[model samples]
Target: MSTRTETDSMGAIEVPSKAYWGAQTQRSKENFAIGHQPMPLAVVHALAHIKKAAARVNANLGELPTDIAQLIEQAADEVIAGELDQHFPLTVWQTGSGTQTNMNVNEVIAGRANEISGQTRGGKSPVHPNDHVNRAQSSNDCFPTAMHIAVLQAVTLHLTPAIKTLRDGIDQQAKRYEKLVKTGRTHMMDATPVTFGQELSAFVAQLDYAQTAIDNSLPAVCELAQGGTAVGTGLNSSPGFAEAIAKELAQLTELPLRSAPNKFAALAGHEPLVTLSGAIKTLAVTLMKLANDLRLLGSGPRAGLAEVHLPANEPGSSIMPGKVNPTQCEALSMLACQVIGNDTTISIAASQGHLQLNVFKPVIVHNLLESIELLADGCVNFQKQCIAGMTANEQQMAAHLENGLMLVTALNRHIGYDNAAKIAKKAYEDNQTLRQAALDLGLVTDEQFSQWVRPEDMLQPE
Candidate 1:
């Protein structure tokens, strides 16, 4: 392949003639071959945003020529639009500070800027990668800034809306099933009575709590490390550079971007990400439990609870005819497990930071973005494939509620707990409904049993 030489502080190296990246990015490509997975597109987009904001801020501050800054900004716009995604080929296992990826963006933007100015791809004249494009910034700050912008944008633009959709879908279903009483279970045994709406409301409440936690965590994530340059002292960066860039980034990304209150702490640890990941982990647990409940409720139309009918999108067994699986619930539950695992990885990565910089940045951002994307997609899929189409087996629910000895819970106020337990045991021993057992044991007349043990009434406190 035809190649061109690009020079950095380390000296000259041959780069692919057609490639947009320079020496450092090419060196990183050759050195870090451990993980083939490319950095996530969200991070790349965020890096583009940061580069553009910095260029605009520098130009405004008279630190860079307006024409050169305009070219860099234009190229970064293209990168943000994903027109040049193929140029970033480095793996996620590179330098802990993500310097390679940062340099990769700088080189690509500079190369594209050079090309736009009628210069060659490897030319470093009017728009040198480090001196011009990466001016007043270090990989130390830019990388974490990119991570913050990416995570906040993802949560605000994708995860929040997806979760809201899920919550709304569940709320609509809850409203629809408000009167569908079923036997509620604890310890996998019948305990009391609850409406189908009440069960679904629990998931809605969980989603609300998760959303609140995520929203509360955003201010910290939006606190950027951009001004910290190499080691939190803002070395080489001009006075007010951090503030200007932060303001420009906020306007550009429309996020609540701010300079970190403590730059050293921001660069040395990713506590904000850790906190957000915890919230996401909680959401995953909620989703897993809800998915399992759906699967259990929809299990075995002929044998198991079968209190609800999941949409039959696929066959459950290869040999068994007319069997449909709860495929969406299965997929959602599996996704939840993966998200939970990713949270653990993020937590560990967050704890691995050294004195000045966190080396685990690539892994942390990658895992965090993966968790966000998985959860967003999972919520959408679960709503589309399962929740939106779920149908209550009203007849089965009524039957279960009528026969459940747990409905005696409502009678505790009238018959006393001891009598209620005795009635339940008597019903189980005789394989009879509690109503019949109460009648046989002279616990109550038919009218009293009907009034006291009504499942619909049992759904609420008397």
Candidate 2:
């Protein structure tokens, strides 16, 4: 490939002629050949938003020339539109502070801006990366600010809506099964009678509570760390730079973003992200339980519980004849496990913040974004493939309900607890119905047993 020499503070390097990144980006790319997990484009777009807002704010404050600021804004807009995606090649494993990725964005925007202004892409002539594009900002602040913006947008625009869609779909299933009475299990054994609708509604309630927790954790994520340049002193930044930039970013992203009240804490501690991760983890746990329950309820057609029929998206076995599996639920459960693991990574990374800055910002944000995307996509896929087409096995449910020993629970208030237990034991021992056992044991008349052992009556309080 053709190459061009690009210069930065650390001398010069040969960059791909077609590439828009500069010397620092090239150096970082060559040095950190660790993993293939590239920095999230969401974060890159967020950084572009920050640079555009910063440029406009700097120009308005008379800190940067209007033409230069406009050029940076144009390039940043292109990045935000994903026109320059190939230019940002840094990985998440580079520089935990995310400085390399930040510079990669800065360099790409500068090179593109320079090219737009009738200059070559290598040299920082018409639009220097640092002075013109990244003016009045430090990687320390820009990275965390970008992290917050990316996470906030992703959760708001993707994860939350996906969760709502799935929750609503499950709720519809619940309503459809509301009157279908089934046997309930406790400790993996028959316990009592419940409507299939009630069982599914519990999943709906869990999702609602988890989504509320995720929503509640977002306001803190809206606090940006942009103006806390270097070490949070706002040393070289103009007086109103922080507030002005926050306002500009809010307008650009249509989020209720604001400058952090304590720049020091914003730069040093990533408590907001940790809190959001915890909430996402809770959602993952809820999803895990829901998926497992669905899997169990839909376990088999002949050999297992088979209380419900999951969508048979694909054939389950290669050797077995005519079998299907709960692939969507399995996939969703695995994704939940991954998100839960990502939460652990985020928690550990967040706790490593030393004095003025957290060097684990990249890992923290990477795991957080990964969890959000996984959950969002997982929910959509599970809803479309599994929950939307799920059906209740009403006949099987009724059969289970009729055969359950726990229905003897209904006889407690009438025949006394000891008599009820004796009747249940006798029925189980003789493989007889509760009414027959009660009649044989002389515990109650058939009419009395019928009146006392109604499963539907036991569904609610007397």
Tell me each candidate's RMSD, in Å, in order.
1.3, 0.8
Local distance difference test, per candidate? 0.91, 0.92
Q: What is candidate 1's lDDT per residue for 162-192, written digit by digit as tens? A: 9999999999999998887888999999978
Backbone clashes counted, model 2: 0
TM-score of each: 0.97, 0.99
Candidate 2 residue 383 C-alpha distance from true site, Å:
1.1
What stretches of model 1 exceed 4 Å from their correct place?
A: none
Sliding window of 10 residues with minimal summed lDDT for model 2:
450-459
Local lDDT at 227 for model 2 = 96
